[model samples]
Target: MFKVEAIADSYDQRVVDVDTGVYLEWLVTGSRYTTEVFNLVHPGGMIPFTTSREYGVDPHTGLPFLVFRFITFGSAVRAQLRTKHLINCTFTDDLAKKFWMTVAAEALVVFGSAYNGFKVPNRRYTRVEVNEKIYTLEDFGYTTSPG
Candidate 1:
């Protein structure tokens, strides 16, 4: 398992609530990346944001954060990854690229040309039996260095 970490805004100040300022920062960052990534997708669609996002709570722990769901298609594969939990994050430059790359890889995995219409042939990936269905970047070969 990889220890994935990202810095996020606290949205607090000494006197007045700085939520607006923090949100605005995310908005600006999100807008910039939205355009850049959209260009890369080119005729594809996306709705990623630096700060603007749909909020949800963890079913078990009730931890809340912004969510950006990505469904990607690569030349050989197509897969979707949800649950890149951006908790008070500004969609930092590094992580935004990471997210984009991760989804692209997943799409390749799902496409199965690499695996030849099956799982990775060498058993490099291990499948687990879980009641809930979710795709992890690790399964598609993404690991984060410690912060």
Candidate 2:
């Protein structure tokens, strides 16, 4: 038999904890979006890192001078973005990821709702054609996503 409660809980947990870090970074960079846009990815619940500025180290000194410079540049970009200096702007990765997260949350609800009124099963049925043909509502459709 399957359990709907367990499946709904598991799906809910996955929806609540999916990570949006990489997605957010991509959104900010104005990159092409991938199908991973679904809400069931990593970290779950709440946005992960809000920003993702990369850094580089020198081959000789192994220092992060390049990274520091990049951070400074990012700060300037952020300021410009906020001050309306950057108009007709595309959504940042973070914003895009957030958008997807919202979409995913909605999808999760739909997924759960699809199973409403399903009854739990107490026994397993063998994979036989005759068995299936003779089964009734009370005898089938109770397996949940989660065990």
Candidate 3:
């Protein structure tokens, strides 16, 4: 039998409005929103995940827009579960993958209530499915743009 669990360890969001010069950033650890997300997605599981939003003047064009980024950790465990636990009917790897995939697909729907005017980027935004190494804001060049 494969016993699986996933939990949201942290939650964060940043919103920058180039038009109005408004900037917002916040961090919530084990908060109701985080718990709610975990319940909606993984239920009884515990996992590490990241959600981010960027908005401001486009670095390349000086235009205003919004971008969303998502990442998940624990590829080794996810992979092992997928390969070793394919049978026995206790737990399946697909469930693990599905949890993260659902988060990536529906994060905005689940957490976008705070941002009133920010919309998902029309162009293709960056997405890392399973990151072996976590990233920093500098890695994404988030600190360079106007708020």
Per-residue accuracy of model 3 over 62-97 as CA lDDT, tens digit each = 555444444333222232333442111123587766
- The alpha-carbon deviation from the true structure for residue 58 of candidate 3, after best TM-score superposition, in angstroms, is 8.9
Quick one: best TM-score, which candidate?
Answer: 3
Per-model CA lDDT versus the true structure? 0.28, 0.27, 0.33
- What's the true lDDT of residue 138 in model 3? 30
lDDT of 1 by residue, 1-147 (tens): 122112357542111112221110111223433211111121223333321123445566555422333332111111112223222123348666565444433432232221121333322232221123334335755453222
- Tens-place lDDT per residue, model 2, 61-129, is 554321100111122243344343322223367666445444333323222212322321212211111
Lowest lDDT 10-mer window, candidate 2?
Answer: 65-74
Can you give the lDDT of residue 47 in candidate 1? 30
Weakest 10 consecutive residues of candidate 1 by summed lDDT: 20-29
Stretches of candidate 1 above 4 Å error? Answer: 1-37, 41-52, 70-136
The window of 10 residues in a row where model 3 has the poorest summed lDDT is: 34-43
After superposition, which runs of candidate 2 have C-alpha atoms over 4 Å from their true positions? 1-92, 117-147
lDDT at residue 103 of model 2 (Cα atoms): 38
What is candidate 1's CA lDDT for residue 22?
Answer: 14
